[model samples]
Target: MNIHIIWDEANLPIIKSNLSNVIDVIDDTIAVSFDTWLFSSNGEFVIEFYHDGQTIIGLK
Candidate 1:
């Protein structure tokens, strides 16, 4: 299953939990939650997105 692709809305919370816990500002919604933060362990910055029970994480 592609995380970027939107699916059932019921999975939103689960997806968000998997990608949760970061120093990022997020505007959460039923369809999608968007956030961005830097990984303190390695200074590896990331942009995290959760939508409809799917998760997409990107590094920068």
Candidate 2:
């Protein structure tokens, strides 16, 4: 299982310490939007955070 995390640079330490299953950690510097519907029916585990807004997605 590979986990893709979209987050800010400031949270790097937190991500490194807490998440051991993360495969890719993408900084949110790029101008992109993630539509919930796009991942809603994928049957994968998706976590959306409001504060700091870190998106964690699991892909097979």
Candidate 3:
């Protein structure tokens, strides 16, 4: 699945370097072909969640 990440352009490079193993980075956000997962570091285990048809999944 193709994944498009949303982040500040300034942080793009750093985020890309870390997530390269899992996703394909693109310059803009558009309709992606596959499921999208967002990962964010929160001073603990990184959180991962998928976007369902309505809202974000895996919220705790």
Candidate 4:
């Protein structure tokens, strides 16, 4: 099974720091990240169902 994630705005500094490391490596003008602040849902917690259902927000 798979689940989607949302990045909590509360964690952006950590995200920027991590991205900066990647930018230093790739040496580019624009910075981007393909990282996630894990869900702790790795077969450990039961996922909830919402009335709207099934959106793939892809921090995959």
> How do the residues 1-60 of candidate 1 rate in per-residue lDDT, one tens digit apiece?
112222234554333222243223234333242332222234344343443345455555
Clashes by residue pair, model 3: none
Pick the winner on TM-score between candidates 1 and 3: 3
- Tens-digit lDDT track of model 2 for 1-60: 333444444433222222332323333322233322112233365555434455444553
Cα lDDT tens digits, model 4, 1-60, are 332332434554432233335335532311222333323234343222222433222242
TM, every model: 0.23, 0.26, 0.27, 0.18
Candidate ranking under TM-score, highest first, comes to 3, 2, 1, 4
Per-candidate alpha-carbon RMSD to the true structure: 11.5, 10.1, 10.9, 13.8
How much does candidate 3 score in TM-score? 0.27
Compared with the true structure, all predictions reach lDDT values of: 0.34, 0.36, 0.36, 0.32
* Model 2 lDDT, full chain set: 0.36
Candidate 1 least-lDDT 10 residues: 1-10
Positional deviation of residue 34's Cα in model 4 after best superposition, in angstroms = 11
Candidate 2, superposed: residue stretches over 4 Å from native: 8-43, 52-60
Task: For model 2, state the Cα shift of residue 38 in Å.
Answer: 14
Name the candidate, 3 or 4, with the larger TM-score value: 3
